[model samples]
Target: MPSHETTPAESVWDYPRPPALQRDPRRIVVECAGQILADTTGALKIMETSHPPVFYVPPGDVRTDLLRASSHHTWCEWKGRADFWDILVGSDIRALAAWSYSDPRPPYEDLVGHFAFYAGRVDRCTVDGYTVRPQEGDFYGGWITPEVRGPFKGGTHTHGW
Candidate 1:
Protein backbone atom coordinates (compact mmCIF):
# COMPACT_ATOMS: atom_id res chain seq x y z
CA MET A 1 0.00 0.00 0.00
CA PRO A 2 1.15 3.51 -0.70
CA SER A 3 2.20 5.41 2.38
CA HIS A 4 -0.15 8.19 3.40
CA GLU A 5 2.62 10.71 3.11
CA THR A 6 3.26 9.66 -0.46
CA THR A 7 -0.37 9.88 -1.49
CA PRO A 8 -1.00 13.31 -2.90
CA ALA A 9 -4.26 15.09 -2.47
CA GLU A 10 -6.42 15.25 -5.58
CA SER A 11 -5.10 17.70 -8.09
CA VAL A 12 -6.84 21.08 -7.85
CA TRP A 13 -8.32 20.53 -11.28
CA ASP A 14 -10.05 17.45 -9.92
CA TYR A 15 -11.55 19.40 -7.02
CA PRO A 16 -12.84 22.58 -8.49
CA ARG A 17 -14.39 25.15 -6.24
CA PRO A 18 -17.98 26.09 -6.96
CA PRO A 19 -18.57 28.71 -9.61
CA ALA A 20 -19.43 31.29 -7.00
CA LEU A 21 -16.36 30.38 -5.00
CA GLN A 22 -14.08 30.38 -8.03
CA ARG A 23 -15.33 33.79 -9.09
CA ASP A 24 -14.45 35.30 -5.75
CA PRO A 25 -11.32 37.48 -5.95
CA ARG A 26 -8.58 38.42 -3.49
CA ARG A 27 -6.57 41.60 -3.29
CA ILE A 28 -2.80 41.35 -2.75
CA VAL A 29 -0.40 43.95 -1.43
CA VAL A 30 3.25 43.07 -1.98
CA GLU A 31 5.96 44.81 -0.03
CA CYS A 32 9.65 44.25 0.16
CA ALA A 33 11.80 45.07 3.21
CA GLY A 34 9.36 47.89 4.16
CA GLN A 35 7.84 49.74 1.22
CA ILE A 36 4.68 48.83 -0.63
CA LEU A 37 5.67 47.62 -4.07
CA ALA A 38 2.35 46.71 -5.52
CA ASP A 39 -1.15 47.48 -4.36
CA THR A 40 -3.14 45.37 -6.84
CA THR A 41 -6.89 45.65 -7.00
CA GLY A 42 -9.42 43.38 -8.71
CA ALA A 43 -7.06 40.48 -8.18
CA LEU A 44 -8.71 37.12 -8.52
CA LYS A 45 -8.81 34.04 -6.32
CA ILE A 46 -5.40 32.85 -5.26
CA MET A 47 -4.63 29.45 -6.74
CA GLU A 48 -2.04 27.01 -5.49
CA THR A 49 0.04 25.85 -8.39
CA SER A 50 3.45 24.19 -8.50
CA HIS A 51 4.59 27.68 -7.48
CA PRO A 52 2.18 29.99 -5.64
CA PRO A 53 -1.05 31.93 -6.02
CA VAL A 54 0.65 34.36 -8.46
CA PHE A 55 -1.74 37.17 -7.35
CA TYR A 56 -3.09 37.98 -10.83
CA VAL A 57 -3.26 41.74 -10.76
CA PRO A 58 -5.08 43.72 -13.41
CA PRO A 59 -2.41 45.58 -15.35
CA GLY A 60 -3.89 49.03 -15.01
CA ASP A 61 -4.04 49.07 -11.22
CA VAL A 62 -0.45 47.99 -10.48
CA ARG A 63 2.18 50.49 -9.38
CA THR A 64 5.03 50.26 -11.93
CA ASP A 65 7.53 52.45 -10.09
CA LEU A 66 8.13 49.75 -7.54
CA LEU A 67 9.66 47.61 -10.25
CA ARG A 68 13.07 47.94 -11.85
CA ALA A 69 13.82 45.78 -14.89
CA SER A 70 16.53 43.19 -14.38
CA SER A 71 18.50 40.76 -16.51
CA HIS A 72 16.32 37.90 -15.26
CA HIS A 73 13.97 36.07 -17.58
CA THR A 74 11.98 32.87 -17.22
CA TRP A 75 9.51 31.16 -19.52
CA CYS A 76 5.93 30.19 -18.83
CA GLU A 77 4.01 27.88 -21.14
CA TRP A 78 0.76 29.76 -20.76
CA LYS A 79 1.96 33.31 -20.35
CA GLY A 80 5.26 33.77 -22.24
CA ARG A 81 8.39 35.64 -21.14
CA ALA A 82 8.46 36.35 -17.41
CA ASP A 83 10.77 39.23 -16.65
CA PHE A 84 12.26 39.44 -13.17
CA TRP A 85 13.11 42.18 -10.72
CA ASP A 86 15.11 42.77 -7.58
CA ILE A 87 12.89 44.41 -5.03
CA LEU A 88 14.60 47.42 -3.50
CA VAL A 89 13.88 48.66 -0.01
CA GLY A 90 15.88 51.65 1.17
CA SER A 91 19.27 50.33 0.08
CA ASP A 92 18.64 46.65 0.83
CA ILE A 93 17.79 44.18 -1.93
CA ARG A 94 16.01 40.89 -2.31
CA ALA A 95 17.22 39.33 -5.52
CA LEU A 96 14.75 38.06 -8.13
CA ALA A 97 11.90 37.85 -5.63
CA ALA A 98 9.51 39.59 -8.00
CA TRP A 99 8.53 38.91 -11.62
CA SER A 100 5.98 39.81 -14.27
CA TYR A 101 5.20 39.74 -17.98
CA SER A 102 5.99 42.79 -20.04
CA ASP A 103 4.54 41.38 -23.22
CA PRO A 104 2.34 38.42 -22.52
CA ARG A 105 0.28 36.26 -24.84
CA PRO A 106 -2.87 37.75 -26.22
CA PRO A 107 -5.05 36.07 -23.65
CA TYR A 108 -2.97 37.48 -20.80
CA GLU A 109 -2.18 40.98 -22.04
CA ASP A 110 -4.37 42.39 -19.29
CA LEU A 111 -1.74 41.30 -16.78
CA VAL A 112 1.22 42.95 -18.48
CA GLY A 113 3.71 44.44 -16.04
CA HIS A 114 1.56 43.25 -13.18
CA PHE A 115 4.11 41.47 -11.05
CA ALA A 116 4.07 38.78 -8.37
CA PHE A 117 6.58 38.46 -5.56
CA TYR A 118 7.65 35.56 -3.40
CA ALA A 119 6.19 36.13 0.03
CA GLY A 120 8.74 34.17 2.02
CA ARG A 121 11.67 36.29 0.89
CA VAL A 122 10.19 39.57 2.02
CA ASP A 123 10.75 40.92 5.54
CA ARG A 124 7.07 41.55 6.25
CA CYS A 125 3.81 40.52 4.59
CA THR A 126 0.29 41.49 5.53
CA VAL A 127 -3.03 41.02 3.91
CA ASP A 128 -4.73 43.91 5.56
CA GLY A 129 -2.49 43.15 8.59
CA TYR A 130 -3.68 39.55 8.91
CA THR A 131 -0.06 38.31 8.76
CA VAL A 132 -0.12 35.59 6.15
CA ARG A 133 1.76 32.41 6.71
CA PRO A 134 3.64 30.82 3.84
CA GLN A 135 1.65 28.33 1.81
CA GLU A 136 2.78 24.80 0.95
CA GLY A 137 3.47 25.36 -2.73
CA ASP A 138 5.57 28.54 -2.90
CA PHE A 139 6.65 31.64 -1.04
CA TYR A 140 3.52 33.77 -1.14
CA GLY A 141 1.72 36.08 1.28
CA GLY A 142 -1.96 36.61 0.65
CA TRP A 143 -4.97 38.52 1.90
CA ILE A 144 -8.26 36.76 1.33
CA THR A 145 -10.39 39.69 0.32
CA PRO A 146 -14.17 39.86 0.57
CA GLU A 147 -14.67 38.03 -2.70
CA VAL A 148 -12.26 35.20 -1.90
CA ARG A 149 -12.85 32.45 0.68
CA GLY A 150 -13.37 28.88 1.82
CA PRO A 151 -11.33 25.65 2.00
CA PHE A 152 -8.24 27.78 1.40
CA LYS A 153 -5.18 25.59 1.53
CA GLY A 154 -2.72 28.05 3.08
CA GLY A 155 -4.74 29.59 5.87
CA THR A 156 -5.13 27.45 9.03
CA HIS A 157 -3.86 24.40 7.20
CA THR A 158 -0.37 25.87 7.20
CA HIS A 159 -0.40 27.52 10.62
CA GLY A 160 2.99 26.30 11.83
CA TRP A 161 4.73 27.06 8.53
Candidate 2:
Protein backbone atom coordinates (compact mmCIF):
# COMPACT_ATOMS: atom_id res chain seq x y z
CA MET A 1 0.00 0.00 0.00
CA PRO A 2 1.07 3.58 -0.64
CA SER A 3 2.11 5.62 2.36
CA HIS A 4 1.43 9.31 2.90
CA GLU A 5 1.05 11.74 5.78
CA THR A 6 -2.47 11.98 7.11
CA THR A 7 -4.10 15.32 7.69
CA PRO A 8 -7.64 16.32 8.63
CA ALA A 9 -8.79 15.50 5.10
CA GLU A 10 -9.61 11.99 3.87
CA SER A 11 -6.72 10.18 2.23
CA VAL A 12 -7.19 8.10 -0.90
CA TRP A 13 -4.57 5.64 0.27
CA ASP A 14 -6.85 4.62 3.10
CA TYR A 15 -9.87 3.83 0.97
CA PRO A 16 -11.08 0.25 0.58
CA ARG A 17 -9.80 -1.98 -2.22
CA PRO A 18 -13.10 -3.17 -3.64
CA PRO A 19 -14.65 0.31 -3.16
CA ALA A 20 -17.59 1.48 -1.11
CA LEU A 21 -20.54 3.73 -1.80
CA GLN A 22 -22.01 6.45 0.32
CA ARG A 23 -24.66 9.11 -0.06
CA ASP A 24 -23.26 12.53 -0.83
CA PRO A 25 -25.44 15.46 0.18
CA ARG A 26 -23.33 18.14 -1.47
CA ARG A 27 -24.63 19.64 -4.67
CA ILE A 28 -22.94 18.33 -7.79
CA VAL A 29 -23.23 20.40 -10.95
CA VAL A 30 -21.93 19.53 -14.41
CA GLU A 31 -21.78 22.04 -17.20
CA CYS A 32 -20.63 22.14 -20.79
CA ALA A 33 -20.96 24.77 -23.49
CA GLY A 34 -22.79 27.09 -21.07
CA GLN A 35 -25.45 24.45 -20.50
CA ILE A 36 -26.17 22.49 -17.35
CA LEU A 37 -26.27 18.77 -17.96
CA ALA A 38 -26.55 17.50 -14.39
CA ASP A 39 -27.41 19.14 -11.07
CA THR A 40 -28.09 17.02 -8.06
CA THR A 41 -27.63 16.61 -4.34
CA GLY A 42 -28.78 13.00 -4.40
CA ALA A 43 -25.54 11.54 -5.59
CA LEU A 44 -23.69 8.41 -4.54
CA LYS A 45 -19.92 8.65 -4.13
CA ILE A 46 -17.78 5.60 -4.73
CA MET A 47 -14.48 5.53 -2.88
CA GLU A 48 -11.66 3.23 -3.76
CA THR A 49 -8.02 2.90 -2.78
CA SER A 50 -5.54 5.24 -4.48
CA HIS A 51 -8.33 7.01 -6.35
CA PRO A 52 -10.60 9.96 -5.89
CA PRO A 53 -14.33 9.50 -5.50
CA VAL A 54 -16.60 9.05 -8.50
CA PHE A 55 -19.99 10.64 -7.95
CA TYR A 56 -22.97 8.95 -9.52
CA VAL A 57 -25.90 11.26 -10.15
CA PRO A 58 -29.47 10.12 -10.24
CA PRO A 59 -31.12 10.19 -13.66
CA GLY A 60 -34.04 12.30 -12.39
CA ASP A 61 -31.69 15.24 -11.78
CA VAL A 62 -29.99 15.13 -15.16
CA ARG A 63 -31.03 16.53 -18.54
CA THR A 64 -31.82 13.27 -20.26
CA ASP A 65 -32.30 14.88 -23.64
CA LEU A 66 -28.70 16.00 -23.84
CA LEU A 67 -27.32 12.48 -23.33
CA ARG A 68 -27.10 10.20 -26.33
CA ALA A 69 -26.14 6.53 -26.04
CA SER A 70 -22.63 5.78 -27.28
CA SER A 71 -21.08 2.68 -28.82
CA HIS A 72 -18.47 2.45 -26.08
CA HIS A 73 -18.69 -0.19 -23.39
CA THR A 74 -16.29 -1.34 -20.66
CA TRP A 75 -16.26 -3.91 -17.93
CA CYS A 76 -15.27 -3.54 -14.31
CA GLU A 77 -14.47 -6.62 -12.28
CA TRP A 78 -16.30 -5.13 -9.31
CA LYS A 79 -19.10 -3.06 -10.84
CA GLY A 80 -19.77 -5.08 -13.96
CA ARG A 81 -20.26 -3.71 -17.51
CA ALA A 82 -20.71 -0.02 -18.07
CA ASP A 83 -22.50 1.73 -20.92
CA PHE A 84 -21.26 5.04 -22.27
CA TRP A 85 -23.09 8.22 -23.19
CA ASP A 86 -22.19 11.18 -25.31
CA ILE A 87 -22.99 14.66 -24.09
CA LEU A 88 -24.49 17.03 -26.65
CA VAL A 89 -24.82 20.69 -25.93
CA GLY A 90 -26.37 22.26 -29.02
CA SER A 91 -23.85 21.57 -31.79
CA ASP A 92 -20.99 20.65 -29.44
CA ILE A 93 -20.59 16.95 -28.78
CA ARG A 94 -18.28 15.12 -26.37
CA ALA A 95 -18.41 11.50 -27.27
CA LEU A 96 -18.42 8.95 -24.47
CA ALA A 97 -18.19 11.67 -21.89
CA ALA A 98 -20.28 9.88 -19.34
CA TRP A 99 -20.93 6.31 -18.26
CA SER A 100 -23.07 4.14 -16.01
CA TYR A 101 -23.68 0.54 -15.09
CA SER A 102 -27.13 -0.24 -16.45
CA ASP A 103 -27.12 -3.68 -14.88
CA PRO A 104 -24.53 -3.84 -12.15
CA ARG A 105 -23.68 -6.92 -10.13
CA PRO A 106 -24.37 -7.41 -6.42
CA PRO A 107 -23.35 -4.70 -3.95
CA TYR A 108 -23.20 -2.17 -6.80
CA GLU A 109 -26.77 -2.67 -7.98
CA ASP A 110 -27.75 0.72 -6.59
CA LEU A 111 -25.64 2.31 -9.30
CA VAL A 112 -27.73 1.04 -12.18
CA GLY A 113 -28.69 3.91 -14.49
CA HIS A 114 -26.88 6.49 -12.37
CA PHE A 115 -24.41 8.48 -14.47
CA ALA A 116 -20.83 9.54 -13.79
CA PHE A 117 -19.22 12.17 -16.00
CA TYR A 118 -15.61 12.70 -17.03
CA ALA A 119 -14.58 15.91 -15.30
CA GLY A 120 -11.88 16.73 -17.85
CA ARG A 121 -14.22 16.22 -20.77
CA VAL A 122 -16.84 18.65 -19.48
CA ASP A 123 -16.62 22.45 -19.34
CA ARG A 124 -16.76 22.24 -15.55
CA CYS A 125 -17.67 19.90 -12.74
CA THR A 126 -18.32 21.23 -9.26
CA VAL A 127 -18.93 19.67 -5.89
CA ASP A 128 -20.62 21.96 -3.41
CA GLY A 129 -19.63 24.93 -5.58
CA TYR A 130 -15.95 23.98 -5.54
CA THR A 131 -14.51 23.09 -8.94
CA VAL A 132 -13.18 19.54 -9.17
CA ARG A 133 -10.03 18.35 -10.91
CA PRO A 134 -10.41 15.29 -13.03
CA GLN A 135 -8.59 12.15 -12.02
CA GLU A 136 -5.57 11.61 -14.26
CA GLY A 137 -5.95 9.11 -17.12
CA ASP A 138 -8.63 8.81 -19.77
CA PHE A 139 -10.38 5.76 -18.38
CA TYR A 140 -10.97 6.67 -14.73
CA GLY A 141 -13.80 9.06 -13.90
CA GLY A 142 -12.84 9.96 -10.33
CA TRP A 143 -13.15 13.65 -9.40
CA ILE A 144 -10.57 15.27 -7.17
CA THR A 145 -11.86 17.89 -4.80
CA PRO A 146 -10.02 19.90 -2.13
CA GLU A 147 -11.10 17.60 0.68
CA VAL A 148 -9.64 14.48 -0.91
CA ARG A 149 -5.89 13.95 -0.97
CA GLY A 150 -4.07 11.65 -3.35
CA PRO A 151 -0.96 10.67 -5.21
CA PHE A 152 -3.61 8.93 -7.18
CA LYS A 153 -3.41 5.70 -9.17
CA GLY A 154 -4.76 6.55 -12.62
CA GLY A 155 -1.77 8.51 -13.88
CA THR A 156 0.83 6.89 -16.19
CA HIS A 157 3.44 5.90 -13.61
CA THR A 158 0.90 4.65 -11.08
CA HIS A 159 -0.89 2.20 -13.40
CA GLY A 160 1.22 -0.70 -12.16
CA TRP A 161 -0.45 -0.31 -8.74
Query: TM-score for all predictions?
Result: 0.61, 0.94
- Residue 7 Cα positional deviation in candidate 2, in Å, after optimal superposition: 10
lDDT, model 2, position 114: 96
Each candidate's root-mean-square deviation in Å? 9.9, 4.7
For residue 14, model 1's alpha carbon misses the true position, in angstroms, by 4.1
lDDT of 1 by residue, 1-161 (tens): 21234333433333332211122233456666567666654664435432233465555655556556789788766667988877666588788777777797755666666656666766644454444554444333433322233344554455453
List candidate 2 stretches off by more than 4 Å. 1-7
The CA lDDT of each predicted structure is 0.54, 0.92
Give the number of the best model, judged by lDDT: 2
For TM-score, the strongest prediction is 2
Clashes, model 2: 0
Question: What C-alpha lDDT does candidate 2 achieve relative to the native structure?
Answer: 0.92
- After superposition on all CA atoms, how large is the RMSD of candidate 1? 9.9
